[model samples]
Target chain A: MTRRRLQILMPWAVTLGLFALWEAFCKISGIEVFILPAPSDAWAAGVEFWPQLLEHSLQTLFTTTAGFVLAVGFGVLLGLAIGSSTLVYKGLYPVLVGFNSIPKVALVPVLVIWFGIGTVPAIITAFVISFFPIAVNVATGLATIEPELTDVLRSLGASRREILAKIGLPRAMPYLFASLKIAITLSFVGSVISETVASNSGIGYLMLAASSNYNVPLVFAGLLVVAFLGVLMYALMALVEGRMTGWAFRGTDLMS
Target chain B: MSDPEFHPADFMKPADFMGPADFIKVDGVDMTFSRGEEEVHALRGLDLSIPKGRFVAVVGPSGCGKSTLMRLLTGLAKPSAGTVTLEGAALRGPAKGVGMAFQNASLLPWRSTLSNVMLPFEIVAPHKRRLRANRAEYEARARALLKTVGLEAFADNQPWELSGGMQQRANVARAIVHEPRLMMLDEPFGALDAFTREELWSVMQALWMERGFTAVLITHDLREAVYLADEVLVMSARPGRIVHRQEIDLPRPRTLEMTYEPPFQAHVHSLRDHIQTVREAH
Candidate 1:
């Protein structure tokens, strides 16, 4: 096979090969179904529960998207404020770091107590967990502008507003997009953690429901669905990142 | 006259030889900047006067406040004591109608070369106000400037797509696109290879000749200072001040070939000697 074709097919081949190995291990060892279901059993569970699984996945997607949008808005504003002012940067950075260090899963219970066990808590959890990377990356991007570039603009009598508009924001775009890919995945983790703890809908809730009844295959199926969704969202973010900030990666010879 | 021995006292007040109606003047400027707890005395008791439409270069040892001089002339910083005047007016802030280019090309990587060249139009007024209405005219002017710098073909290319030399060419086009009357170059050609640097020297010369903008270049290259400037100023060590002034009476429209000739080498040698003497004295 050609190199390009091999590159495209490699991931699929490896994934299927792993599934085959897992299926063989279960068939030979005769492991208990509750402990570990075979790949075939998981596949059967997915096929049978397609409608419910789809609904849960869609709920998860909705909460994650809503939370991610909120994150983008608040994160960028906070980033601008912090990046533009030394006072804000010094004051808020420690607080942000402290908040980010706490396990986001630990906050799901608090969110449930405040918002009463539903989609609201899941969304708020996602927003809180995922916004840190975006805010930090944007601030870093703005802070690290080449002094020479600023000198050129300042010598032209560019005001702070003009400098921010022309250079700061656009320069921070790559950093923002980079954090989006990371933040979107983090949003997924946040949403699911909340759903598993408190919400009635989403893949995490579905998995929790299945596990209670000792339906190991159904739980595995839900997990597979969530993993697929995470990959899909990450791919979408990569696409948008390429479209928006191709110049940042131009050194890699990926774009003309 | 033959062996120009360097002497700080003889050149201390070179302003006496300066023309009456100086375009840019630094009068007894003293610049001291603080870095953390330590106060760094950069430039001290410095005096410089540039005639209108003359190309001047300042060459000195490292840390001798050559950059500080450029900052004062451009009015990017106020001297702690003395006044920096441009065209008979004391500059309160960054001088208006001045173009600056730095050692690095420093082009916005996202912008195409043409867009980069048009940047001053988005900042420097009344061009900023007129730019939208006369965008075609301004674009044409930018394109023409690019052509002069030999970058007309790469105007649509990103800065990363171009070679380092081409990027610097684009940088020069961006600097002159707004047609500022005063141009400040901060070791603009310092990063390039020798051949590329020499090639750009000609491009720079042609631009200066065509525009007649009063130019100040800060460089460590003795040959570059001698080859480009109408006069070269040498600076003393820290608490820096101009210590020697040498006029290059060499004829204009100077070429790369002319740089090979004895007169050019002689000028370069003397300036090198002055710098060596200045460094040792400190």
Candidate 2:
């Protein structure tokens, strides 16, 4: 195979080999099924609890998607507001940094109290955790425009709105998409954590119930679902990002 | 030696001064920039007046405020002590009739090249107001402009799909598609390779000649200035004052062949000497 194709396929082959070894070690050592189920056992558990697992998976997906979309919307708007004006950026930067530094997980109890146990608290938790990176990335993107480009636009008598639309937003897309990929994965984690702490729905709740009952295979199934969801969301985001900011990725091949 | 055809406004004026038929005037201008208690004098007592259809080039070293002058002329920056006037009116802010291009072709990557070129039409008034109703007409004009810059084939392509020279050409098309009377080019060819830069020089010259619009080109390359400008203004080092203004007595419709001639060499040598003196003085 060509080096490029080998590089691409090598990681998957390694991962598959590792999984096979893990299954063999578990079976040979005769580990308790409740402690560390084999991959086959986990798959069987998934098939048996398919209906409940599907429901919980859908709940996690919904909350994660809702939280991610809201975070992106608010984050981009806030970022633009902060990025465009020097005075506002300075004024809000310290407060934003302070808020971002606080452990967002600690706010779970407060969020549950405020939003109640269902999807609301979980979504809010995800939003709280994932919004900061998006805002920071977008603000950096918008603020870091080439001064010469702005000068050219200004001399063209372009209006402030035109500058924002043509220069600011387009330039920020790559950074925005990058932050989005990070934020989407975090959103899933946030949703699961919040669901574990507060909700009776979602993959997090399934894992918690399975662990209490000593159903290790079922717990593994729940984790597998979460992993699948995270990968799927991340892949979706990557696809969108590639479509939108493909131009940003060009011209980097020579450097690479 | 006054002829009847030569009006009083046409005679006895500084060769660089805008005659009665001129469109824009930069009167004795001074610009000083302050950053954290240190002041940098960028332009000092600068004056230049551009006739309606003349192509003027300003050549200077780095940080000599050639760009500052372009900004002042376009009203992007007001001179600290003097004024820029357009058609006898004081320019208080960015003149809507002015269009600009730069060394970096700042085309919006998300938009197609044709759409990028049509962007100004959607922002500037009259055109902006008419664009919605006459979208086809404006798109046609943008396409024609792109074609003139040899980028008609890439009209639908994103900015990244284009080469550096092609992107810069698209940038030029974007600047001029609005059909502005005054075009300000600040080192637009500085980022390109030697051959690409020379190629763009001709493209720009042809565009200016066809449009009959006044142009102010700010370049560090002496050959570029001599080849394209009707009058070349050389500014001194920081606290950049217009130290010398040389009218290119060379016949117009100047070709690349002229750049090799004795007169052309002399002009380039003389300008280089003056710039060296300015650099050494500072």
Candidate 3:
């Protein structure tokens, strides 16, 4: 009970301590807020521009989530295709690895060429960056099935389709959820990168515009919102993972 | 129906030598498994006859292709040479109307005990077609099978929640849930404690007495073979073939106490001696 409570509380304590130290150091040094806005300055900016912050935050959130949902849908299907057969696994795995290696930011200008310099490019960038992890994790899960399970299912006269449907997909679920948590945060990075490059309205665009106008407090406020939303989405995914795939969570000691 | 390229029946010279009435037969079979650059011959000249509704046990040393034999019976693997037939028909692919259980008690951890037991109904023939139409009936059938294996109370429990013995019991229930014509058990009780093993022995015996499926059990324990089987066959070391066959004429409803008697001990010792000889020879 104590451990569970400590797990939830400890990170907040650390965050508060770090912010306090940072705030104190800035006050003691008499650093200008333009150079490095204090936590108080960022907080004041956030409250002062609450409506504008929310509007832009919602834009960033929608684009990121749309791309993430696309990644999940496509990633699982691609993973299954690669994982189900040795032939497909060998043929396509290298291609996927090569694709994942290319920096997604480079794809932003290309996406801009295809779609205009706006939400579409941001959504595409989010998808390109986030989908790789989901695909790889799910593929790894299915490809490494227990031989005994296959033997039993086959000896029962289950077809390949049946085996994959009944066993392979369910076995990959924990991996899928784990990837979702990672991919969700990565999607935010993807969206912000594209937005910074070229987008009309999002926190990333707001930050870029504010920084250009020397609004340091507003820039810091945007950063806070992005981090806060990223962490919140990640926590949501972890909760869903606990509820949906708890059975797959074997003792961690066994994994080593 | 099996392979047209090589008819299994023709593999045996003098085909009628194996009585026509035999329910299952493996004739002059040879199974070879090849790795990257090396070939390992796992079975040779493996001939066997299982009469209808008989309980048979195969005992052999480790690395003696005992598992390979079980795999062949299930039609999971075809012989490199010769034939394996069930009820006078060639087993080409995975044999239909068959059930199998391994030593590991391979219940999918995510599923409840009853769901695991009902797994075959989701994949196998008429059951799969009938499942959506008769979900309640099939579930009742699964619960009944679990009851037979003394797992009725744990029907809704996850597999990991159960002890090893309890899981094995569920495994047994899963294997028999479809009411198959043949039951192939490979070291089903090999992992259990002595007391739990003996307890399951009675459970198996009761199940066999009631169901009367043709059971071909592959086990290393001679005592297990002699205690549960109507006839026990001792297998030679790798390139495994039946070396000796002992028919247990002991009366039915045999108790665990009978396993300690002179007659039962005699069968166990002889079977042990045969396996010991095969092991040493190899």
Instruction: Flag the better candidate by TM-score, 1 or 2.
Output: 1
Cα lDDT of all candidates, in order? 0.89, 0.85, 0.89
TM-scores for every candidate against the unseen true structure: 0.93, 0.90, 0.93
The TM-score of candidate 3 is: 0.93
lDDT of 1 by residue, B142-239 (tens): 99999999988998999999999999998888888898888999999999999999999999999999999899999989889988999999999998
lDDT of 1 by residue, A1-256 (tens): 8887787798899999999999999999999988999989998999999999999999999999899999999999999988878899999989999999999889988887788998999999889989999999999999999877877787787877888999999999999999999999999999999999998999999999999999999999998888889899998988999999998998674432
CAPRI band of model 2?
A: acceptable
Clash number for each model = 0, 0, 0
TM-score of chain A of 1: 0.95
Report model 2's interface C-alpha RMSD after superposition on the true interface residues: 1.9
Lowest lDDT 10-residue stretch of candidate 1 chain B: B1-10
In the range B1-282, model 3's lDDT, one tens digit per residue, is 122233445434444555766878999999998988998889999999899899999988888899999989888888999988777677777776578888999899889999999999998888999999999999999998889889889999999989999999999988888988899999999999999999999999999999999999999788888888999988898888999999999998889999989999998888878877888898
Q: Which regions in candidate 3 have their CA more than 4 angstroms from the true location? A: A1-4, A250-256, B1-18
Taking the tens digit of each residue's C-alpha lDDT, what string does model 2 give over A156-205?
A: 66667778888899889999999999999999989999999889999999
lDDT of 2 by residue, B6-112 (tens): 13343234444446776777777889999889998898888777778888898887988888888888777778997677766667676674679988898877788
Identify the runs in model 2 with alpha carbons over 4 angstroms from their true place: A1-12, A251-256, B1-22
